[model samples]
Target: MATPARTTQAATTRPVRYAPHLYNDDLAPVRKRTWGTYSIFALWMADTHAISNYTFAAGLFVLGLAAWQVFLALLVGITIVYIGMNLMGHAGHRTGVPFPVLARVSFGVYGANIPALIRAIIAIAWYGIQTWLASVALVVLAVQVFPGLSPHTTNDVLGLSTLGWAAFGFMWLVQLLILSRGMETIRKVQDWATGPLVWIIMLFLAGWLLIKAGFDISLTDSLTDLPASEQWRQSIAAVGLTIATFMTLILNYGDFARFTKSHRAYRRGNLLGLPLNFSLFALASVLTTAGAIAVFGEAITEPVEIVARIDNPWVTLVGAITFIVATVGINIVANFVSPAYDLANLAPKYLNFKRGGLISAVLAVLVMPWELYSNPVVVNYFLGGLAAFLAPLVAILLVDYYLVRRGHIVVDDLFTDETSAAYYYRRGFNPIALQAFLPAAVVSGVLALVPAFSAVAPFSWVLGVGIAGGIYYWRSGRVRTGPLPNEVIACASSSSTPTGSTPAPS
Candidate 1:
């Protein structure tokens, strides 16, 4: 685990090339700023490339869209993810801190806890879901590795069969061991896992389809397989859902962005990481999924399943090993690490990053992850609900940072609980921020839950963002305002570029 580091004076005084918001008393800034656009590109490989992700993307077939329309929908949806990632990237680059500490800025010194916990809870839920999904591959791999284990598949207990329990435990223990080592280990492991996973899957997809479909199919097959009615529904839903899915992560991205050497580095990383990386992965995913249909005579959404269809033992073995590694990368980054920072943010005094993350990882086993994935319908509902939480927070932050503060932040005042500090808003919590969050979240939650609102409910995130921003502007008045200290000013002046209220130039 990364031990905390002190804030260097040069961090804020220079051209703000360093991570600003992330440097707290307890956590040190990442000493080496070695990650670049390509690292970020690989990071997305880890983020978006996964067994669950392929399932989710191809699940668009349920929306009744043809494969081509589904592809178009995916393109539109992920493009939004691209833009959202860019916005989130700014926070990371400007602050040089992780997510939880940076929340102190927009959420209020104490008020930040609410958003942090919200994000943490969402991360925990996903941790369970991702773990459950990865267990699918684990079970497949186990049965292949040790064929005698198959008899245990039917032995049911506590909803899951004995084999299911073993697989879940296998994934659980592996994640625990990986996570306990801390962020550095996670980063290096992620870089290694995602690259090979992609290569093997691409190879598997080509060879599988060439054997069955005679390599006659193209990536555009998904476009041709669409159902007019369902495809349209899913296409639009995918757009909104994609935005909602990635939007909250966008707001809290400073959790990692605080590590960059320059804002330029962050921007370069995001551009490579999001749109370009996401789109290409999505395309490969759909093609393989379609190829699975031709090869196996059943529509296979899971990549592990597609590889399992291979006849060669060595090919299947390579696919099995890569699947395990890929799921590890996705689960930790998208789930484990995020919740760790979130819970730590909630009670910085009681739970630092490692403890917070540990609590989340341990609790995941207790959730009976199998129950979480028992019904995909139930899973989507939870995702929609979690998407509701970020709206109000996003609205308040955008309004306060851009319209109110005009993209400036005071570093020291953020840490100090002193009455004189800029961030210590009366009694160390900002009611205005709270006011924005409650109503927006409640309404969005209801919209997401109710069947009547299904059409627009996928848009719950955007609705929440809009509602929060408008409410903050409407209610905004008479709050004290002033320029931050010389240090903040120095950072701001140095990073200045011609722009509007971006709050982040780099």
Candidate 2:
């Protein structure tokens, strides 16, 4: 892990004057960089080792492709994600800014809130759904271990059963406690619980399934029965969907990458985390699904369902609790942390990290995500809608940072509301970027919603990104620039705030 840089008294003699809307300790550049390669690795482990990821991998097997074909597609898709993340991580690692603040360099100072709120809303939805999923696992375990409790499971309250409410409320409180402690606690939980323990349970679960199936599992059995043309087409589409799964993280990776010690450390961590870790996870998921099919004569995509089917009480209990813990780790890293920073970025003066997190948690409940997840049509619509906005936003950021500005961000100017600041374009809005985003987003949304274009929906993120990025690059004249200017370098050297600020009293 990276060590904290010592703060010189000169750097902190008096805090720099900052606009009320633009500056807070939480939104400031990190002074003491502490995350290293393993933290990044563990982040991916936490994000990917959940019920949703497992189901996504198992769903790929049903796409009529051979196992080798699926693996190849995964490799290609993940490599693209790896490249995109490295590009996004550069700004954060160098400047010590979160995603939304980094976005101001491209979107303009106040305009950054548009992308920030959009990403935060998406995080809120997923946060509720993942917490609900963990609660469902708890419900399953409760029913199995104590059959007498089953009688009380169906008493309805607020669209959830009595027992469902109990489990959901419990998980909700637990997440709040974790979030209350802040990011360091989240990092430690993920680094320790998610990386090793969850993998062990998953391996054990896969082994049990294989043994139960007489060790005759085969991922390609169903695919071999399909026509060649269908297999090839579905394989390509599956790769697109796989890429879409990580689109949210790809856009906001700077939220975590900002804590890294260096760009080299960031890249090394992603190399191990994205392609390598994902491949191993996909393999295990496929094996587990094949085993389920061999034993039960039907594919079981959900790990919770697979655990519940086991007759051994002890095994079922362990699997259920492990999955609950895994979901919490993922929820904290992927959902909680992103919005905590994103929402805090929206109103820096009043809402610090903890208050922002509390707001996200409350909104998660208000959104009634349980109803959304229960309906397949609603889930698809929600995810498709998110893709439309997210894709264009990511494209705009990449184009502005890389091609337009030549990766030269004046860090101090990012927080200043001064009319002369480079980022204060047209009262804190970039017309060129908005022009690029709106049309591309409309086209992507149409492709996602229209049945005639449904086949193209899987690649909606790719299409939006490419279209918006190309348009922005064409409209914004390319400017070649070198390292930070002397003034910007001096500002960076002189500001020495702590990494994560102590939350304001609630």
How high is the CA lDDT of each candidate model? Answer: 0.67, 0.79
Overall local distance difference test of candidate 1: 0.67
* Model 2, TM vs. native: 0.91
Tens-digit lDDT track of model 1 for 1-506: 23222232423332222123323233322344556556666667787777666777777653344556666777788777776666666655554456665666666767777787787777787788778777777787788888999998887799877888878888888888888887767667766767656766676675667677876655443434556576577678888877777765676766656555666766776777666666666666766666676766766777766676677777788887787777777778777777887776655556667787789987887777678777788887777787788767766775776566655565544554556555667676877777878888888998988889888898877778888878777776633254434324213222322111223342
Cα deviation at 35, candidate 1, in Å, is: 2.5
lDDT value for model 2 = 0.79
Per-model TM against the reference: 0.86, 0.91
Candidate 2: misplaced stretches above 4 Å?
1-16, 483-506
Reference-based lDDT, residue 477, model 1: 69
